[model samples]
Target: MAWWKLHKRDKPGSPTGAGGAVLASAAIITRDQVRSVVGKGQEWQAQAWDFYRTVSELKSGVRWAANGCSRARLYIGRVDPDGSSSPTPVDAQAEDLSPDLVARLLAPLEELAGGQLGQSEMLRRFSVHLDIPGESYLVGFDDPTSGDRRWLVCSPSEVTSAGGGGTIRVQLPESQSARVELSLDDCTLIRLWRPDDEYAYLPDSPLNGLQDPLRELRGLTSHVLATVDSRLAGAGMGVMSDDVVPASPQQTDGANPVHSDPVTAALIEAMAASLRDRDSASALVPLLLRVPGSVKDKFEWHSFATELDSNLLPLREAAIKRLAIGLDMPPEVLTGLADTNHWNAWIISDDSIKLHLEPKLGLIAEALTDRYFRPAWEALGVPDPEAWACWYDTSDLKQRPNRAPEAAEAHARGAISDAAYLRELGFSAEDMPDEDEQRRRLLIQLATTNPQLAPAALEALGVRLPNIGQGAATDAVRAPVEISRVAPAVEAPARNEPPALPIAASAVLDDGWRMACLDLAARRALARAGNWLLSRSGRSRRGELAHVPVHEVHMHLSPDQADLAQMLDGAYRDFHAATPGETDLHAAVDLYVRRLLLTGIAHERGLLAGHLAAAGCDRAAA
Candidate 1:
């Protein structure tokens, strides 16, 4: 038999430490049998029964006993209630390890084996889980009976498997060491034992929230980081010491210095630098999307596209995965390589005989559209057909002297549209509308009318027209179209009414000064006309006149000099009087011819008339 007793150090009235057998006296007995002295079924008596019942299930009594009861010893340390002396520790005589105790200990385990309850099921009913902090980690558990339901907090890293059922190791809250193992063979048993409270921690569990869909990008980030580390290592510091540079120091010194291989920091800086050309930087997106490991943190593609001008190229898994899993960009947007026309021109238009153009890789979708796709349209081959008429207005194709004449003819022949041509120059048709088309047409018309316009006009159109005179052509191709002889002017039917004083011819003329007002009026008008052609479609302006209206067409006059009309007028009479046979047409004659042409142009511009009487012809006659 077991006994309970207090040691000599225990306080008065405390039972002897080994008097465990008698410790289960009236105080320990159930109140149901104590109604004679105590009151009938009270709340306190009910609570006592519940506690005893719970304890009884966890223990088993031993029947065979050999000796008399041995008292249990207890030790109680003195306590200083006012902190006058010291605090005391308390200990009590422990009860016997009876059969009821054994039964209680195995109660959950037996229930688990019998398919009554599960071993380790998630407790999802409570607001908060209780975590006992240890040296390095925290262990969490469900609080039973405190709230409406129970909860069990487990490790997120732990994997729960249902084999021959599962196993849950229940731990005691007071001691970090306490535990009880239970095996549940039936799924129903585990389900029934599940708690109702919700238990969650920071960074929410996968079930609590969707895990980062871009987690796979972490691999790419790691690769990039590794590459960056190697690059940085290779770029040696000014001073070489014995030990390695501290990583923290490297991180703190944020600006990345350029080195042999591009580090991630340098690459990122490069990307940022590209953003300065906001338009072109968009091209980097496709390339960047392929960079693994948290690439999402590096750039926001949509915002970047909207903010910067660039091109993009989809290279590997990183970019493709994000396309499928995260972003909603369209397929055309993603693969928007430059149009065929521009690409072909860029690659073949050059005179290198073997063209080499290499674009950066891993660009984003938007950047790809802007940088690679748009510019590539011309070289890639024109996409549309109707834009050729005004192609010179918005593109720079016709000025390529090195380009094959066939290509220039192709442009002039409406084989390619302005939009297609610009697309070849890496421009997008999405934003450019029909209004732009009309504007482009007007500008081209203006440029074509100006004979004095620079070759840059054709360059803007993407094709340079080679100046091939009849002498340059093969003899077999000297074929000429029959021209009608100068016929007398035919009279037109007179209008019944005179035309209204047509909104002042000045309205059609770009220059405001009239011929009567200034001697330079004609020259000024000519210059104004040249200026008008040059300004039209080279760049864009949004306000004021949306388009220009024309009243009369004044074709440009060709001459080597700027004031060709004045030069030509000065040489006209002399050149006309020179006797065709008598004059020795030597090198000086060629020079005189050039001067005559120049003077005629200047005369037309109201400058000076040509004095073409072959040099000393007039003086010789005198």
Candidate 2:
């Protein structure tokens, strides 16, 4: 369905557009019917699974880890022979794919088993099981022979090896048991990084290291709950003298019997009973203990000694940090939201994705490719399943600043060229016109300066003058080059276009040395201004220039484009600053025109800034 699939080269006898179809195949069928497993297989690992289940259910670090991973995007990508060799809006779409085969390959993953769970949500639950038990199982039954199949995530409890290598028995949800072929023929094992490389069956969970801290936390939570309950029940026990007997058997308002001997219990219980349905806004509740002799003098009440669990929250935070570290995520990402700012948050997330999440996602992708995708392809007559497989896009996790406006401003200032500007926006500059506008504008300025010139004179300078009533305006850039009645540029237009100047105006300027000096000065100033044209090449013998490195463009520059354009502009304005004011009338007019023509020629942006370095002096004539 993707656009890049169109360029497939048709080979004789090959199926129509089948080259890019293997990876793009939507549904994979397998002969070994899969049975979705529910498990309780490892009794030795029960405690760890319990830890995972408890924390995952509660508002804890495991929940944070799950939420962080749920944003991942999973898609199948494969290289096409006709893949895009140019820039694409999204960097993830490396190439194009074939639709027919790709659709079949992709069919099962669209709904991802049972029409509810998508790939991301599946991975989320999968990650939780993996992180908690250090091992997770999946049984995908894509029975080409059957009408039903389920890609199921299994618990560490109900699934286990069935006495033999590469065989697993799953306790199905239907309360039936089935033996699964274990080379991912029917079931797959997705596990964490185990230090014991030899024993793939038993992997280590982060909870193993967190056991002591968690146990202490549970104890702390229990103690606090007990303290609160004690407080709620009259805040303490009441001690009464034993000799004091009740006048009569006492009863609460609800007819519950109260032992008359313990007047404190009678009083407190009576108080509690009266307030059960009382108006919450009213602070008063009356209790009649009905104790015989002066009970207040005989009875004494003492509140239990209790201390606050101030370290509970701090300890919980420490536990979350350990979990984050175990999961290879930034601690700040887990529980440090208040401390994160907009600027550093993006950086932290980018680092977390690159360093931690990438490898985990890779493992899951590989498992899916091998156990699910490849087999389905094999059934569908795909000879090479490796060509197309599952891969993840963490683009959602990629946070970056948009510098579009800044890039536009810089390009307008000529600190960057059109190609550089296009590259800034992830666009290709390949088809842009090669013509220079700056040089074209210079030609227009020269011809418009004097309306007195003949039609033939305009042609002599290679100027395409506008129609009769169409007046034009142009800025005359002046540079101090010596002049002797050389009022027009002749012999060559000195641009990418073919020659246009006429032969009648071909008289060389008397002072050639002054024109050369002006050209040399302009080049020097431009070089000082960062030799911007050279940098615009975006590369040099030093490997890459300031332009080649997109991320590094704003970091460093020698003179840069803005400075080059600005300095070259100043050089033009100075060219005619030396036109003598003490000349005779005719000679002064000739000198002004001559210098104007020279300065305009110098300001030309085409063919090496009016061909100053190579042929500017040679191209200019009277």
Candidate 3:
């Protein structure tokens, strides 16, 4: 067989390797030996037949048979996941066998099975690491010529060299049972005198090999073994495949095993029913939206679902009514919710809940329908229900101060202010894509410029105003004005120290003379007639011709200087007028007086305050 080719250099299988060598030795034995030494009935027969088959296969090559005979031995030990020496195997299933007998069988194996082979090679040779100490193995051989399957029981006597362990040999009685109990500690290793190299033997084939049959068997066995390993690793206690096995229970919560436990099935049904009965659901809604096929098998769960189906109309009505009341809407306006099936269908749909909630929105609906209202106007950034109640003292967003005006106004005006408020709250006009900015602007203009509004209030409202966290308000630029800083004119004596004047010109000058001169100067000034000699004295040009300043001042002025400056302005104006666009001293003085009068009038009227301030003006400047 192909397995024989792979084992060409090593001793083959369990106690039978030593049995084959004994067959080669021509030892004599009996059928009672076969039964007592190997095992009973078919077990003994199978071992004997296998030993005979092995001998037949080796008989073709004397050299191969000689090599196998010299290297013959068998050993069994437990392996862990890490491929470490698992010195002792914990008893997963305790039996009623005597403890002392089990102990005496195991101590020798523990001392003998150490560092004989690499971990990987040992595992590759044996499919499972037999629990040597906690398991038992009865090993011996049969004589071929005698046709005897008699075998000897083996145990450790003492540890000799670190490599060579002395073992006890027991020749069994013909009447004894052959099946030995195995624990990790009660394991054994067979050794023999040979003329060739020593060989390590495994009872079972390894997991992966050129041998196809064993490879498949190893795959299934290893998977089961790994599961057991995992359970043992988790808890200190070990379990067998038959104990705590998978029950194939019904799937609930997507994790429970399926169709096994009645109580678990009932609990799952009740849970699913309660979830279905919920009026409002959030994150878990998606999970329950499509019930799992496994849960559908639970009749009680399906029965609970039936109750929900029958009562759905009232449930839908109650849910819609609650949403409407929260929205401060009347039930009639939201009649679309009366169809429970449609509502339920929409509930499970995507963000399309917007479509279902549309009719019930009331004021939100009106604002949304308006061409001037932006979609953002619906965002109303009203805090959530909890916050809304804490802040506004009610969950009703309609009763909010800003939204209160939405009800009284027609759809146009209501949409306008609503849109504006949302924009002020930081929403963009695009958020209300249906609403046009033109109508919004027009509404604002009408509110500010209406003839019916109070003038002052309307004026204040004409400018664009900033809202919270917005840019500064626009303001008008005003010109600055300069006020006279000098004290008002008061009388002061002339350097000449002249006598004080009378109250009237007649008291100082002769009445007849004062009247004749005032009348003559008034006529001369109007007629553009006067001498030019008095122009150099710095007297007014109008005064030089009109003589009014002289007439009034005669009472306040000394008589000696009165005649010192006389009508010379007219001649000066005439001389300056001779040159094109050039004014003489007299004309310039008169022009200056006229300019002053105009500027003073504007200052008194408060027209140039900012302009004068900008120009660095003093009291006389504007």
Q: TM-score: which candidate is best?
A: 2
Decreasing TM-score order of the candidates: 2, 1, 3
lDDT by residue for model 1 (1-622), tens:
0000001111245342112222111111111212221112223323322322332211111000000001111111223446563223222112433444333332322322122122112111100111101001112222343422122323211212222324434443456675533332211111111111352111121111111322323334445444333312222222222242222212324364444333444444444433366345332332232333443444433221211112112223434444333221122223233563654554433321111100000111112122212222222233321111100010132234343434434555689776655555555777566876776665565455442343455556565788756455432223321211132111111223322221232232323342232224233333443444333322333122234321011222223443333332333233324433333222223233333233222222111111212222222222
lDDT of 2 by residue, 1-622 (tens): 2111111222356332233233211112122212332243344357666555555422355555566667877766663546552112122443454556656656545635453345666777766765666666655544434635555666666555554334555555655554343434443333223322455434555665666655555666666555443333333445455544433434556575565557666555544542553443211322222334555677656644444455666766676566556554566655567767877778877887777677667767765665455545655655465567677777767836665666786897789888877866778877554556555554455455433333545676575766754223211113222443233332334424533333321322234565454444444443333343343433353255534332122223433322323324343334345533322221222232233233332222232223332222333442
* Candidate 1, superposed: residue stretches over 4 Å from native: 1-415, 429-516, 531-600, 604-622
RMSD of each: 38.4, 13.7, 42.3
Better lDDT candidate (2, 3): 2
User: Local distance difference test, per candidate?
Assistant: 0.27, 0.48, 0.28
lDDT leader:
2
Candidate 2 stretches greater than 4 Å from native = 1-38, 43-59, 77-117, 141-150, 154-198, 232-250, 253-256, 267-302, 307-329, 333-339, 401-622
TM-score between model 2 and native: 0.50
How many clashes does the backbone of model 1 have?
A: 174
